[model samples]
Target: MSRNIYAFLAIILLLLQNCSGQKTDTKFYDKDFKWSIQIPKDFTKVSAKEWAEKQQKGENALEETTGEEVINEAKTIFVFKTDDMNYFEANYQPFDINIDGDYRENNRNVNHALYQTFRDNMPNARIDTLSSTEKIDSLFFYKYETKIYLPNNQILDIIMYSKLFDKKEFTVNIMFTDPKCGKEMIDAWKNSKFEK
Candidate 1:
């Protein structure tokens, strides 16, 4: 249970989640957040069936580790992947305003909890970088970057950004082991536009 199996399960779930025939083509838009991001044309959407199966596996793995089922009520906005194991997924989950009523601080707290879980449970996980702030287009996102060493001697790099929009949490998860794909993803996300 101290192994990085949960991390591997996550990869399977994400790969299955958006392996459908759907493609981003150009820009992905969301009216609730008033946001749009540029994505590569070659990305394919994850199938619902695959997403569900993989998601459950991930949840089961978590339950075994934490001794409780953390309910996943987050609704996926989209999940896209390429043949290179590069993935991008967006989801919305509940965000409770803290007692201090600070939006960004609350966002940062959520990211901290996730990273701490990785450190506490996964033995070989290395937290390359902790919480940082980055402004993409007009949105300010609290970022968390981590590198998890797999049992097969491969590295899994994950970059996650979260923000609160209208009192809800919106997150973008980018997972890639390839350096080239990571650069490409960073460029695409950096150049994304927020539609007025």
Candidate 2:
């Protein structure tokens, strides 16, 4: 009986140590003349340089659409500083009609539209706006969270927004699931410094 008690005590102590061993660190991403941001630790940093390069290459691909199509597809969570306002201007020109109203009735739209519908239907849905706090590097940003229901009844907690680096003429939009995991992603972004 004494040996069993000793074994149990050892297991309890090990469990406590394991729990206490977890650490949380704040990571930042900095860019020259542009805004910086924080990437949480839970998320894996998926090559910021590659994303930027893709954006640069795809700039002209989106130009073929008319203004109306652009507005319909512009469910962007964040807009970086390098975002071409000309694209926005071309897509959101002075049209007296409500673009959302026209698109809201369509069931064939993508996940963003579906998420919007879920948000509208939720009785407890709320938007928490975070002030621009703690510059990741040089970028300025705002963060917001909203709980959205998926088609399977699973609730998706999301953190999203755009970071602007005006001097670098670049902008970054980050969208992620699990708000708790955002801390890690924010940290990775901070560590990367957004130079690429």
Model 1 scores a TM of 0.76
Off by over 4 Å in 2: 1-68, 71-134, 149-155, 166-181
* Candidate 2 RMSD to the real structure: 18.9
Which pairs of residues collide in candidate 1?
17-46, 17-51, 18-45, 18-46, 19-46, 19-47, 20-47
lDDT of 2 at 21: 17
Clashes of each: 7, 35
**CA displacement after TM-score superposition, residue 97 of candidate 1 (Å):** 1.4
lDDT of 2 by residue, 1-196 (tens): 0001111111111211211112223334333323244433322222334333333322222222111222222212222211111010000112111432222122123223323433444446443323233455564543333444445554444333333222111223333343434444444445545443
C-alpha RMSD (angstroms) for model 1: 4.8
lDDT of 1 by residue, 1-196 (tens): 1111233346534633334556657778888777788787777777766666676776675665566555666677776777536877777766566532676655554455555556655666555556688998867887777777766676768887777766577777788877777777777778877665
